[model samples]
Target: MFRMIPPGLAEAARLTRQGRLKEATALLQGSLAGTRPKPTPARPATRGRIFEVDPATGDATPPGRAGFFSRAQGRPRPAPPLAMPEGARFLRGGFGAAQGERAWRLYIPASLPAGPVPLLVMLHGCTQTPEDFAAGTRMNALAEAEPRLVLYPEQSGTANAQRCWNWFQPGDQRRDQGEPALIAGMVRQVMRDHAVDPRRVHVAGLSAGGAAAAIMGESYPELFAAVGVHSGLACGAAQNLPSALAAMRQGGGTSTVLATARPTIVFHADQDRTVHPVNGDQVMARAGAAGLRAEVERGQVPGGHAFTRTRHSDTAGRVMLEQWLVHGGGHAWSGGDAAGSYTDPLGPDASRAMLDFFRRHG
Candidate 1:
């Protein structure tokens, strides 16, 4: 018999290669409604399972069902409201734009430093709220102690049933558009409302939030002095659901959007399951700084896990990229509190380390 293949799959591949990811996704969704046509590839198609939860990218559907946010795997579900600390206020507000709007929580310390203080933007992972993320990361406490501004931009359940940042969407991955634009708007609003040092603004996130942080840093390198990604993928890791799944399971394709390099620090557990650790490697490579030299160091937290830290410096001798591989760590934030969710207290204090890194870079 003559070799035959699924015509739609070939067309979808072409569409993907052309960077028409939504068209490709729609084609596959429509094609899968029918039986799989016999394949004619000389190389047999690999048999494996793609994650079902990814389509939550659109239609807000969760895995094994036609809706979003049934639950997140392997984490206690708690969306606790943040507690106010002495002499500090956690205020809520929203930033609106033509494309969309994002509600955010700002942490104002009891007393501000004499000069305009740095602004740190924190994006929470999927299924997490600003309050839950603030509690889990203990970021607000740190901001109060150091007396800086901390902003937490929220992802709406209406946009993502799991309340994810939608990092995989092609539109959301670019500058001056989509989710990045909305987040940047919130940051600017905070800057205008407070005494924020323009050059000292920074951004970071955990997991899905981390991935979104990468996009923000890449999209607005001049805006964010440094970038921190905890257990996250690089910018342009995926354009849609299928590509996002592949990028999460493995390292992603070459960066689709990159320009001047910014100071970046990344953290990923060696044993992370939800997002493969190899993705951290990709984030470092995405820096694309010149004549980079990498130095490795290993250290163990007093009562916590051991980690390997690699610093990549350009010829100018400025360490521009740092990667921390937490041994035996999982998908949770390293050295995080358990009060909220998806936190492991046994790793290095990622929040403090990120702040330190931001200080040096900014």
Candidate 2:
């Protein structure tokens, strides 16, 4: 029998088979930094059932389909528009660049403490806008409550038809390059304009955005003190679309070496068909591969969802990784507002959990 493997994955698998765990991990993780290949019109071959719904009738298209959207089985219910949070100034702006321009939305608290406050950079998932993500995550409420500054960098449709962060693309996965540079630049801009504590800046995202957040932590550990990845893959999980599709269908190939890794917290639903639950495990595996101790616990969210949480700590017992797997949950934000899209109101509040975890690290 003959089978073809993606170059990056094949190399990683080979290293793992030879028992060179450390080298294998580094190769898999660093694969994201590989150069971008020339654009080809051919779509990546996909395995597994397509998760989508016919928008016109709101019915599940039979077994195999062309598009992707892990929408609720039927026509999706209309989500209400997100209301602006009180005591926060919702401002829109643009970031200039050599590559192109990007639109950004910032939420600044009306009142500030005597000293510099924390900053949280949030990246939205596919088919979502800043307004929609803000509404769905209800992150604005948390920002106002914490008196923190928040930045939402939107992915233009020009970059991707689904408005997804190019996490699978090599150029977009490294520090000071492609999308990562743009996002880091946005953080710098916010820091300059506000009383943001440089040491307290953190980044978090959902799905593709989550994967990008992981890359941010990997590439700019100096800039970001902590990271939150919700239903996302580990950094360097895939280098291109085909590899990405394969990674999503099964799991990412192997692991790689990283210069540094910031404290990370992950949230995922065990039943997440869109990205797969094992990716959550990979996120933790990659984080702990550098000799961190891991402790696992299982519990259920009150009247909401059941979950397994794994905490990784350093030799000194400082927590480095917090991975949460929501049992019986789907591909949506846990404990999110119904006002936004792709949210599950029943799980433990990821927004709060991440905030608490981030504060400790910052």
Candidate 3:
């Protein structure tokens, strides 16, 4: 006679087949918590040297108990080189003014020729400086290849200790308020200082910064031609933990398209842990629901990641969405240079794609 198998047992069997027996077992044990404790991997104690550098003098402070690169143990490392392209310039400071805190950073491609040039704004994630983002994205390389000006707006740790974009907060998500205003202000400042082509401006970011890019596109449609979000979600679609979780699980929301001026969109994501892959689909869906013509194109890249492209159509032209869903990738920048943080240069080059998309719109 045949016997019935428990759901947990079946799940464990599936996980074992997929080489995720440990995770499967954990899930099974958690489901039956009262019966027995779940087994866990033994984590080794971490040990490393800590080095600190002063941003002003570019000098090392000294090391402490926490190994080098440990913020808690070391003084603070000197700000790394921005690795900007030749002729890049530092524009005005104080781009972001939120909650009595001031944010600042540099702008690249200092000199634009007689004709207007496309503008690309790069936002950094939590615990990151503008210099770090510039170095990581290596967008400067693309800026050099193409005639686009890149803007780097920094987030002060004093405002939020984590240096996150504050997209999760309601105040920062609204237009003409908090980080959104500051980011828009920066865009305006760049336009005023340089001959930036209004029709070709684009925005891109990583993690929390990615979420902020979506917010910028939602709030200031006329200001940005297209937006690139790497591993982030649409604003208002995720406000708190539960909403964020749901958005991550299901993807997409019903936010109106902000860019009446031009086609709005491009979203890149990895199917790995950390940020959910569904967020990419939700972004595309939101763009489509707003009457923006959307299309999805699929391909494969290095490191066994599947890349998808979703393009939105408008009067000006089609806005492209390129999602690089790395199979086992985590929260990191794809096709980034090794010198940058959390970058896997081996993956499809996102910077190149951003430039190509911007050029198409321009």
Tell me the spans in candidate 1 whose CA falls farther than 4 Å from its real position: 1-77, 255-260
In model 1, the worst 10-residue window by lDDT is 43-52
Per-residue alpha-carbon lDDT of model 3 for 270-323, expressed as tens digits? 543445677765665555535655566777774546666655556545554444
Ranking by lDDT: 1, 2, 3
Where does candidate 2 stray beyond 4 Å?
1-3, 6-80, 259-261
lDDT string for model 1 (189-237, tens) is 9999888999999999998999999999988978999999999999988
TM-score of each: 0.80, 0.80, 0.70
User: Candidate 3, which segments miss by more than 4 Å at Cα?
Assistant: 1-79, 84-86, 96-101, 245-269, 289-298, 302-306, 310-322
Task: Estimate candidate 3's alpha-carbon lDDT, on a 0 to 1 scale.
Answer: 0.61
For all candidates in order, the CA lDDT equals 0.77, 0.75, 0.61
Q: What is the lDDT of residue 96 in candidate 3?
A: 36
Query: Whole-model lDDT, candidate 2?
Result: 0.75
Kindly indicate the candidate among 2 and 3 with the higher lDDT. Answer: 2
Worst 10 residues of 3 by lDDT: 46-55
* Clash count list over all predictions: 2, 7, 14
Strongest candidate by lDDT: 1
lDDT of 1: 0.77
